[model samples]
Target: MTKGNLAIVLHAHLPYVRSEEPGSLEEDWFFQALVECYLPLLETLEEASTAKDQTPKITIGLSPTLLSLLEDQVLKNRFEEWVSIRLELLNKLETNCTAAALDLKGHLKRQLKSWKSCKGDLIGRFKKLQTLEIIDILTCAATHGYLPLLRENPEAVRAQLKTAVREHQRLFTNAPLGIWLPECAYYEGLDDLMSESGLRYAVLDGHGLLNADPRPRYGLYAPICTRRGVAFFGRDSESTLPVWSARDGYPGNPNYREFHRDLGWDLSIENLKKIGIKEKRPLGIKLFKISSQNTSLEDKQEYDPQAAKESVEKDAESYLKDRKKQLIKLEKSMKIEPLLIAPFDAELFGHWWFEGPKFLSHLFIKAKREGVKLITLKDALQLTPQIQLCNPSPSSWGQGGFHNYWLDKSNAWIVHEWSKAGREMVSICSGGLIEESNIKIIKQAGRELLLSQSSDWSFILKAETTTELARERINLHLKRFWILINAIKDNKNITEKIIDEIEKEDCIFPLISPIDWKKKI
Candidate 1:
């Protein structure tokens, strides 16, 4: 008999980084994630689905902004060109890293083949896997607006939810039943908004559930239902620590590829500019291994594919063994079957941890042989419909497990901007302007307001990486927002040319409804 269930959730997200210039830093961010993470992940899932017995069951949350990028034909063409350029560069890369270069080339060629096989329609391939019951897809907020911070204007929060739900349905052919709330953040009464958007469940950090109004009897082993009818699954640290902890995790293994040492940083500026890189930045051509935890970047050893493959197998087995032992112990203490939830950022696989996809492949194969029940969050809910009702505590997965990370000294200023813009959006949307030009302005203004509210800029400000870019993005969106709001209010004749330019730049959430911002009585 199965001891318990394991739910592996991967939340995929990226800020709206679409740019007009190819090889721009922002564009590179998206392209690197696609080449390293998304494509490899798709291939892994497709391969796992063909297993004769016990196909892998996983939960994947695709943020609406990410979905929009995936569907953009222009970006797709750019991505193809981006890969071709890298392949050409690899051919001329003459160094002692020949083995590492060859391995990377092989992986990239396979990924390119997979991309071509699907004709670059990754969304469709993921949808097909969902249809096959190999994976369950969850939708996130339209721009991943931090809901707790947006709570002052409930309509602002509503627009985020409604817009996300509409976009998910538009692309996936069905409404998303669950959401990976931005930053795994929650606040009082947020459940009501989720229910209004037709979301049935969400996942939160462990404390959000463990410290609920009435603490859950099963702790983090089972999901709890909120009074508003939405269910919540808490992250299980026991299952996640082994994978996420840098000091203790499998990704830190010496045989794994080093993340920081890349060819882009080592290559001369002249060589980089040949591939359109104007500055010294990561070109994603990593060939070094950790070698030793204390080793310097220059002293790091070359990555060995064979040793890394061996490590993946060893770690996968150990992880499964640990889960089995934990479940067996929990089975004796609980009357209900225990469910272990492991949620991570999807980029961690292949992108952050080069062998992460291979690790997952080994994990699924081991899980089947070891008789461990691997499942999706949806499957876990069906397995236990009669869940405890509890009011989850206000929480986030950020530092301090509260709102401080997004509200700290570096980023506190943006909160007021979000609130002020949100209030204006509600007023203009509720004003019932019937003029065609005004309605058009209102819709575009709504998009800007939503974009400005993305948690990414604030996050970048707090993290202190790319702060200038983050500040520029926030100011850009808010500036555009106020400009359009003024056009609607002042009855100014804004040129169609100006509106088209803004639309072309930040075009996303085509089905966004300004009426979602209307105050509810």
Candidate 2:
């Protein structure tokens, strides 16, 4: 038994990115995450658990949209093709390569090998991990909808909860025990809906607990239960900062992979164009190290895989020692074994910070040796079942630590359209138009509505990188939804062409039912 416990959570998400268009940028995001992050994390777990009789515990929140992509037969095959392209590019680079490019070539080969090894059965591997008690899976709100902004319509929020539970059950064959409230966005009574959906616990930012009614005695070190019986685990930033911060985190060390210095931007356009890669953008083959924080892209040093491994080992040991000392300090005066919850975006590891998955694998093994247990949120609660009852404040882990990143002037106009479509969805579904007679159209409308409400579109609008595409996505989904809704209302003949296109384009939640959108009032 360890004196302290750490729960490291990875929230893996991307909005519905499948498209009818070939080489779609949105779909590229999905493929990149799978290649760079998801596969590596899975491989780490697979290798770490090779020893019989010991299961490594990791909590991951897989969003419905992300799971939808992973299960898409078309996208699954395309991801293999995506890997092949990078391997071909590296093969071409091998002839005139520097030592740095040679090392990156080796990395690409291993990624390709792993992709083949999985044989399009990644989800089965995840299920195996859970069955082995090595990974505890959590679901996110359907469509990755930011719940606080959708508070005006409780029915809409309830629909998100219902769909998550339903979709998770379809894939995992069991209801999930926790949810990553999209962006950790929480409101006054969201937990009641979660409890009703049969979830046992959820996580929030530290401030969400600090401001709870009567305050918490353990601050972010303990779970607090709402009157609704749902437990809220606050994120301990102290556990996160050493690895996640961009400016000072261990990932920024001089030997780690340089994220921005890709050969896609450095090579000639004709070379990339031969491989179907577009001009002036990354093709997921980076070859440089972040030699210094202020170094220019062209001057960056070569990435040394051996040196980076050393850095990961040293950093992981330092982190485990720090936590052990922290627990010793807290135990001196505190009554219970302190729990530290460190939650981070899963993409940060192999995608953004190339050494992230390796760091985590090391952290887990080291913690076990140092007498600090790596427990899932579920296991931690079982160890310490006592909870403090309080009403958590309305909070979000967004910009400004509230809802400004979602609700500010840059994207405020979206709420009106989302609310209007949401109210109409509940009304139309409740009005018996959801019958088996017109169920296909109703389900498509529900799908379009969910896609339009994705928080990524609004976040993109604010980020200004793809504002045009973001606006078009939101408006197009809303437009398809209204066309379906009004056509059903008018009893008009809908063209087969339109229906076919929508069925292909908005293909997510394969088992979603019209009843999932029912008004809960």
lDDT per residue for candidate 1 within 1-521, as digits (tens), equals: 46799999999999999898989999889989998999999988888889776458899999999999999888988877888888888888775357888899998788888889888899999999999999999999999999999999999999999999999999999999999999999999999999999999999999999999799999999999988889999999999999997668999999999999999899899989887899999988888898878999999998888899999999999999999999999999999999999999999998999999998988888897876889999999999958999999999989999999999999999999999999989987777763665777788899999999999999999999999999999999999999998888888878999999999998898888888999876
lDDT of each: 0.91, 0.85
| Each prediction's TM-score versus the true structure | 0.99, 0.96
Lowest-sum lDDT 10-residue window in model 1: 431-440
Candidate 1 vs. true structure, TM-score: 0.99
In candidate 2, what are the lDDT values of residues 241-307, reduced to their tens digit? 9888978889889999999988778889888677776656777788789999999999998788888
lDDT of 1 at 136: 94
Which residue runs does candidate 1 get wrong by more than 4 Å?
A: none
> Over 4 Å off in model 2, which ranges?
52-55, 94-97
Q: What is residue 499's positional error in candidate 1, in angstroms? A: 0.1
Clashing pairs in 1: none
lDDT at 433 for candidate 1?
A: 66
Which number leads on lDDT? 1
lDDT of 2: 0.85
